[model samples]
Target: MIDNTSLAVVAPEILLLVMACVIALVDLGVKSRLRNLTYGLTLASLAAVAFLTGSEAATGETAYGFGRMVVSDSMGNWLKCFSTIAMMVCLVYGRPYAGDRDMLRGGELFTLAMLSLLGIFVMIGGHNFLVIYLGLELLTLCSYALVALRRDHTQATEAAMKYFVLGAMASGFLLYGLSMIYGATGSLDIATVFKVIAGGQVKHTVLVFGLVFIVAGLAFKLGAAPFHMWIPDVYQGAPTAVTIMLGTAPELAAFAIAIRLLVEGMLPLAIDWQQMLVVLAVSSLFVGNLAAIAQTNLKRMLAYSTIGQMGFVMLGLLSGVVNGDPVFARNAYSSAMFYIVTYVLTTLASFGVILLLAREGFESEEIADLAGLNQRSPLYAGVMAVTLFSLAGIPPLVGFYAKLAVLQALVVSGSPFYIGLAVFAVVMSLVAAFYYIRVVKVMYFDAPITATTVAAPAEVRVVLTINGALILLLGILPGGLMTLCAQAIVRMLSS
Candidate 1:
C-alpha cells in the first residue's frame, strides 16, 4: 500500500473528506434553526484546504505509489482554487433556499459536493488510467445522487434516471477505452503509455480506437455535441443549486481530465486527435448555440450555451495558434483555463439569481418572469446585465478577454480554417449576445409582470455585487490578469 505519510501532498483533499463526514454526522440530529451550521463547517474546512494547497511545492510530479496514478501541477492547483470558490458560492446561495424548502441540503449536500471536489482534484492530477477512471466514477456517482437531491420532484427523479442510465454506459465505454489503451501500450500509466506510442512500436489501430472511446466519454462529460442530449434536461430538472454545482464544478473537472489525457498522455498523437477535436468543436458550437436560441427556459438555455463554450475551449486546446508565434501551446492552454474560470463564475452568479428567485412553489426559470426587473430593482438589473454582457463576450468583460486569447491562439497557425473558425466564433458570440441581451432588455425596458413579486435577499445581492465587479474588473484591466494566467500555465507545463 502507498505510505499514508505521502498524503501530505493531498492534504486539502483529505481535510475535505474528513470534514464532509463530520458535517454529515453532525447534521443528522441537528435542529432546523441550526442548519446554517453545516454551511459554516463546510466553508471553514474548504477555506483551510484551499490555503494548504497554496503551500504545496510546485514539483509537477506524480505522488506516492499509485505508480503514476496521481500527479499535481500548477494547473491543477489553479483550477482547484476556482472550483473551491465556486462551490463555496453555491453553499452561500443554497443555504436559505434549502432551509426554506425544509430540504436535507445541509451536511448531506455539502458532503457530496466535497466528495465531488475530491474527484475533480484527482481527475485533474491523474497520471494513469486507473486514477482517471476512479475520479470519473466518483464524480459521476456523486452527481447522480445530487441530481435527485429533491427526491419528491418527478422532474428531478426523471433527470437522475436518465443521467444514471446514460452515465453507466459512458463509464463502460471509458473502461473499454482504458483496456484498449493498456492493450496497445502494455501499461496503464500515462508516461509509459506516451513512451510506448512515441516509440512507434505500438499498433496504430488499437491506439486510435482506444482514443475514440476516451474522447467520446469525455465528450459526454463535457456535454459536447452529439453527446450533449442529456444536459438540457438535467439542468432544467435538477434544483438550481445542484445545477450550479454541475455546471461549474463538473466542467472544470472534465476540462482538467481532457488536458491530462490529451496533452500529457497522448501528446505524440496530436495529429490524430487534433482533427477529431476540431470536428467535435465545430459541431458543438453550431448545435449548442442554435439549440440555445430557441429555449425560453433560462437554465436549459445556459446549459446549451455551456456546451457551446466547451466547443470553443476544445478549439483553443486543439488550435494551438498563438498570435504570430509558432509555439502557441502554452498560451492556448492558459487561455482556455482562464476562460473556464470566468465561465464558472458567470454561470454561478446566474444560478445564484435563480436560487434566490426560487421559492417553495415558484422558480424564476422563464425570461418573461424577469420582465421589468430593472424598473423594479436597478441593482438586480445591473447585475443581470453584467452577466449577460459577459456571456455575450462584449468588450472589457473577462469573457471578451477569453475570446481574444482564443482568437490570438488560433491566429498562430495562420491557416484559413483557423481564421474561419475565429470569425465563426465571433459571429456566434454575437448571436449569443442576442439571447443574453434579451434578458437585460426585458429586465430593464419592459414593465414588471407583478409589482409585489418578491424582493431578492441581501446575500443574493452581495453575490451579484461580487460577481459583477470581478467580471468588469477583469474586463477593464485584463493585462495583469493575463500575465498571471501566463505565468500559471507556463510554469504548469514546463515544470
Candidate 2:
C-alpha cells in the first residue's frame, strides 16, 4: 500500500492529471463553440496546482515515500511551481497564433502540456534511477507529439524526428550510467549511492565510470556544451509556443535533477566531478555565446543563450562555493534554482514578443524580421528591449542580478580557479551582449521589412505586458526573490 507521505507529496501531479482527463472528456460533451472552455479550464487547473505548491512552500513540508523513489522537498516544490507558470505563459503566448492559424483545438496541446508537466514533477521528485528515466521518457514523448502537433507542416515533422532520435540517445546514456552505478554499489536511490561512496563500498573503477555517464546524461538535459547540438534545430523548427515551453521549463527541471543527483548522490566524491563540471561550464559559456552572434533566427539565438545560462549554473555547482562549503560540498543549489527562475521570466518575455510577431506566413524567429519594429509597434519594441537587455545580463535587469549573485558567490569562495573562471564569464557576457544589442539596433534603426504587418490578439498583448513588466521588476528589485532562493536552498540542504 502507498503511504500517506507519497500521497500528499504527489497531490499536485494527481490534481493536474485529473484535470487533463476532465478537459478531454469535457471536449466531447461541450459544444464546438466552447473550445475556449477547455483552454480556460486547463490554465485554471495549472494555476490551482501552483497554488498547492505555494502552500507547500509556505508550510515547509517535505515528504518522501515509495522507498524514496518520489520526493517532495524544497527542490521539487520550486521546480513544479515554476514549470507550471511557464506552461501557462506558453499558452498565453500561443493561443492567438494557434487560433489565427486555424490549428486544431482538440484540447490535445494543453492536455499534453499538463501531462508533460506531470512528468516534470516526477523528474524533480524522483529519487530512484528507474523513476527518473520513466519521468524523462514520459516528458520527452509528450514533447515529440506536441512538436508534431502541426503535422501538416514538413518542418514540424522533421523536428519531431530529430528530437525523438536524439532524445533516445541521451536516455541511453542515462540508463548506461544507472546500470554502472547499480553494478558498483548495488543501489538505485541517489541518496544510497552517496552513502555507498562515503562508506567506500564501491570499487573506484566502476564509480568513475558511473559518474562519467551520469554527468554526460545530465549535461544533455541541461543543454550544456558538447551536448547541445539538438537545441537550435528543435527551437527553430517547433511552434513558437512549444519552443517557449522547451526553452524555459525543461531547463528548470534539469536544474532540479542535477541538484538531487549531485548534491545528494555524489558529494562524497566531489573532487572527481568538480573539474569535469568546470570543463563543461567553460565550454558551454564560450561556445554558446559565440555561436549565438551569427544566428539570424531568434529562436536559435535564444537556444544558444540557454546553453550559456546553464553553464553559469554549472559554475556555481563546480565551484563548491555555495551557502556553506568550498573544499567540501555546499548548498549552491539555491543559486542554481534562483537563476532558473530569472531565466524563465526573461525567456518568456523574449519569446512572448516573438509569438506576437507571428503572422499568416511568418513566425518572428528571424532577427532581421524585427527590423523597423519600433515604428510598427512601440510596445513590442519596448518589451523586446527589456527582454534582450535582461538576457544579456545588463544591470538592474533581473538577469544581470542573477548572474551577479552567482559570480559573487563563486568569487567569495576565494578559489583562484573559480576567480579566473569568473573573468572568462565576463568576456562571454560581452559576446552575448553584442547579439542582444543587435536586436535593439534593428528595432530602433531599421524600417519594418517589406511593408509587413503583424497581427496579434488582445490576449497575447496582455501576456506580453505582464511578461515585460515582470522582467524589469525582477531585474531592478530582486531582493525578495533572492531571499526566497536562499531560504529554499537552506531548507533543501538542511532537511
Candidate 3:
C-alpha cells in the first residue's frame, strides 16, 4: 500500500504526470499558431515541478517508494530540478524557431517535451534496474517522435530513424547487462546488487563481461567516443528546436543514470570500470577535438565538441576511486556534476544565438553563415563569443572553472597516472581552443553577408541575455554551485 511518505516522495512526479495529460487534451483545442495555451500550461507545470524538486533537494532527504524500486534523494532531486529548468529554457528558445518553420502548428511539441521530461525524472529516481530501463525507453521513444515531428522534412525523418535504430541497440545492451548482473547477484535492486558485489561471492569474470556491455551502452547515451556516431548526423539533420531539446536536459538524466548504475550499483568493481572509463575518456578527447576541428558545419562541430566535453566528465567519474579507496569519491563525482551543469548553461546560450539567426526558409547552419555576426548584432555576437570562449576553457568563464574543478579532482587524487590524464586533458583543451577561436574570428573579421540587424522577440532577448550573464557570473562565483554539488553528492553517498 502507498503511504503518505511514499506519496510525498513522488509528489512532483505525480503532478507532472497529471499536468502532462491535461496539456495534451488542452492542446487539442489550441488553435493559436504558437499554441500559446499549451506552452503556458507546460511552463507552469515545469515551474511547479522545479519548485517541488528544489525544495526536496534543499532538505537533503533520501526516501524510497514503490517497494524501494525508486529513490528520492538530494542528488536525484537536484538533477530533476535542473532538468526541469533546462526544458523550460529549451521550450522558450525553441518555440519561435519552431513557429517560423511551421513546426508548431499543433501543440505536440509542448506535449512531447513534457513527456520526455517526465521520463528523465523517472530515470533519475529509479532504484531498480527494470525501472531505469523503462524510463530510458520512454524518453527515447518520445525523443524519436520529437525528431520526426516535421513530417515533410526528409532530413528530420532520416535522423529520427537513425536515432531510433541506434537507441534501441543501446537500450538492449543496457538491459542485457542488467540481466547479467541480476543473474549474478539474484537481485535487480541497486542497493542489493551493491551489497552482493561487495560481499564478493559473484563470479568476477561474469560481472566484468556484463560491465563491458553496460559501459558501451552508457557511452552511447553520453555521446562519448567510439559510440557517438549518430550525434552529429542527428544534430545536423533535425530541426534546430528538436536538436536543442535532445541535447540539453537529457544530458543531466544520462549523467544521473551513469551515477546510479556504475557508482551506486557496481562501485565495488571500481578498478575494473575505472580502467574502461580511462580508455573512453582518452579516445573521446582525441577524436572529439580533432574531428571537431575539421567540421565546417557549426552544429556538427558542436556535436564533436560535446564528445570532448564528456571526456572531461568521464575523467571526474574515473578519478573517484584511487587504489580501491573512495576517499575522493564525493569530490570527483561532484566535480563531474558541476561540469555538466555549467556545460548545459553555456550550451543554451550558444544554441540560442544559432536559433535566433535562423529565419524562415533558411538554415543558418554552416560556419560561414555566422560571418560578420558581430556587425549584424553585437549583443548576439557577444553571447555566441562568450559561449565559444567558455567551451574552449578560457579564463574568467564558467567552462574554465568547470575544467579546473575536474582537473583539480584528478590532481588531488595523488596518483601519477591520474596526473598524467590531467596533463592529457589540458593538451586536448588547447587543441579544442583553436576551432572555438576560429568561430569567433569568423564572426568578427569576415565581411557581413547581409547588413540587416538580427531581430528576436523580447522574451528570447531577455532569456538569452540572462543565460549569457549566468555563464560569467558562475565563473566568478562558482563556489555556491560547487558547494551545492558537493553537499548533494555527500548526502547521496551517506544515504
| Error at 311, model 3, angstroms | 0.2
| Backbone-clash count (model 3) | 0
Candidate 2 vs candidate 3: which has greater TM-score?
3
- Mind giving the per-residue lDDT tens digits that candidate 3 earns over 1-495? 788888887898899989999998998888988888898889999999999999999999899998899899999999999999999999999898899889888888988898899899999999999999888888999999999999999999999999999999999898898989999999999999999999999999999999998999899999998999989999999999999888898999999999999999999999999999999999999999999999999999999999999999999999999999999999999999999999999888888889999988888999999999998899999999999999999989999999999999999999999999999999999999999999999999999887777888898999999999999999999999999999999998888
TM-score of 1: 0.95
Local lDDT at 400 for model 2 = 90
- Measured with C-alpha atoms, the lDDT of residue 427 in candidate 2 is 90
lDDT tens per residue, model 2, 276-346: 89989999999999999889888999899888888898987786633334442343556667788899888
Best by lDDT: 3
Q: What is the lDDT of residue 372 in candidate 1?
A: 83
**How much is 367 displaced in model 3, in angstroms?**
1.0
Residue 27 Cα positional deviation in candidate 3, in Å, after optimal superposition: 1.2
Model 1 stretches with alpha carbons more than 4 Å out: 1-5, 57-65, 321-326, 453-457
Best by TM-score: 3
Off by over 4 Å in 3: none
Q: How high is the CA lDDT of each candidate model?
A: 0.80, 0.83, 0.94
Tell how far residue 234 is off in model 1, in angstroms. Answer: 0.2
Question: What does the lDDT read for residue 318 in candidate 1?
Answer: 82
TM-scores of the models, in the given order? 0.95, 0.96, 0.99
